[model samples]
Target: MWGLVAAGLFALTGYLAGSAVGHLGLMGHPLALRTTHCWTTGPSTTSRGGSTGGDWDCTGLAASGGRTHRITATGFTSYPVSMPVRVAQEPWGSWVPVDQGGWNKAGRALSPLVPLALAVTFARWTLISYRGWRNSRRLPTGSSE
Candidate 1:
């Protein structure tokens, strides 16, 4: 039971770490020219089941203003094909400015703490588990001799 709990905790930490790293990667970047790409939606599935319907995937690849010289982002959306999108530039590509408003902004504010939380959780678990192992090793074994 404890092992299963530990496994779940580790998985959670991994997810948090990935999110923190992704957010940090886009820090201090500029927004992209929105009008350069086309936008559309298609059939999508939710995580609960393979049953499709509840989701509409906005799939579109946008190009840079010939600066980076390639398509930078997918799954972006905008009002008109002629208008620029509200996207932030990342090192590898562009990202929708979802973090700029509402609940997403709250999530963005909390993201930087994930790595620290993960590190602390991992260290505490490691030390506790290691001490338990060491104590078990030092215990006397039962035998009839």
Candidate 2:
């Protein structure tokens, strides 16, 4: 009941926060890689009080023209280390050149999930809350029995 509502709210907050930070370039600009190797850290949790959730992060070693650079990516699921990746320049700076194509591709590949997940959460919570409310209304308000 309240837990579902809180979960939905928290999901919405994360969606908004990630979108805002991603746009502001705090996460970094996307860099296309010809070759790379990624090592994913196990999903980690952030808990305060009763809420619990986690995200996966991967560190990639990308080689471009004989130079290798380290890149980090945060995602809901772990990426295949063998797959080529697009990483962004940190808000401060980066060793890799920022690629507009990579940035656009990253946005296209990743942005859809955020809205979809949030929508699903909203729908679930709405349905559960509605059902609970309707059921409560159908119940005897007073001990007429």
Candidate 3:
């Protein structure tokens, strides 16, 4: 029941995402994630947690159109000297930019299928679990077979 509801919500999200762009869920206006290829300006910072490393950040500077912009990557550490940085007026800009976010034609076409797949999987598991529970209830108490 809950799974079906979730499927409906997710399906709606995919549809909205594919049709138009907005600030809401999966509706971010696509932006061409292209700008100056920024190069690292200083040393990166990092922190490690118990098992998984906490986080890393690298600062960079990009020069384009006689203007230099500073950019930072939170989860990126020392490695590539240059990285593509996008400057946008809106915070959600490039949030799901089709060109950069891999929202290809096929992806848009098949987005609705994901919810169906999830619903089927959830229903199957629930049915199997319910049958097992029913069979267990039918067994006499203290029976180990």
Candidate 4:
């Protein structure tokens, strides 16, 4: 029974440690911008000067640019969120962006299983302990019956 209890505790500790390490690894990365764009609007039809060209309607133009741009007009524009990015590590290792919310969601999904495992382990140990106690109580005081 004691051995069972010890093994159960060991397994629980290992799981907790692994979870901590996983979270730490997930957080160790730098945020980065993955994409950008440049839009222009004018009467000139020439697509030169780094401008891609007007769309089918000839009313606007769009070009792939970066957050670092030199705007020369006053018009409605938008910058959408960049694509997900990650930092590269050594020759064979790489660092990927961590989705903390996703990790938390996964943890929540596993929470129920954790308790169930612990309960089963503890119940097994408890049953063994109880059985041993019952057998001891049935033995004669000092006669070894």
Instruction: Please name the candidate that would achieve the greatest lDDT relative to the true structure.
Output: 2
Model 4, position 112, has a per-residue lDDT of 48
Tell me how candidate 2 scores on lDDT. 0.53
Sorting all predicted structures by lDDT, with the top scorer first, yields: 2, 1, 3, 4
Candidate 3 worst ten-residue window by lDDT? 23-32
Q: Between candidates 3 and 4, which one is better according to TM-score? A: 3
**What TM-score fits each model?**
0.50, 0.30, 0.32, 0.30
**Best-fitting candidate, measured by TM-score?**
1
Candidate 2 lDDT over 9-110, as tens digits, reads 666656655554443345644555443333444444557445333434555576656777766655423343434655554333433222235665476446
Kindly list the per-residue Cα lDDT of model 1 for residues 72-109, writing each as its tens digit: 44443334343444445444344444334466656755
- Report the Cα lDDT for residue 64, model 4: 28
The worst-scoring run of ten residues by lDDT in candidate 1 lies at 53-62
The TM-score that candidate 4 achieves is 0.30
The list of candidate 4 runs beyond 4 A from truth reads 1-9, 24-97, 102-138, 141-145
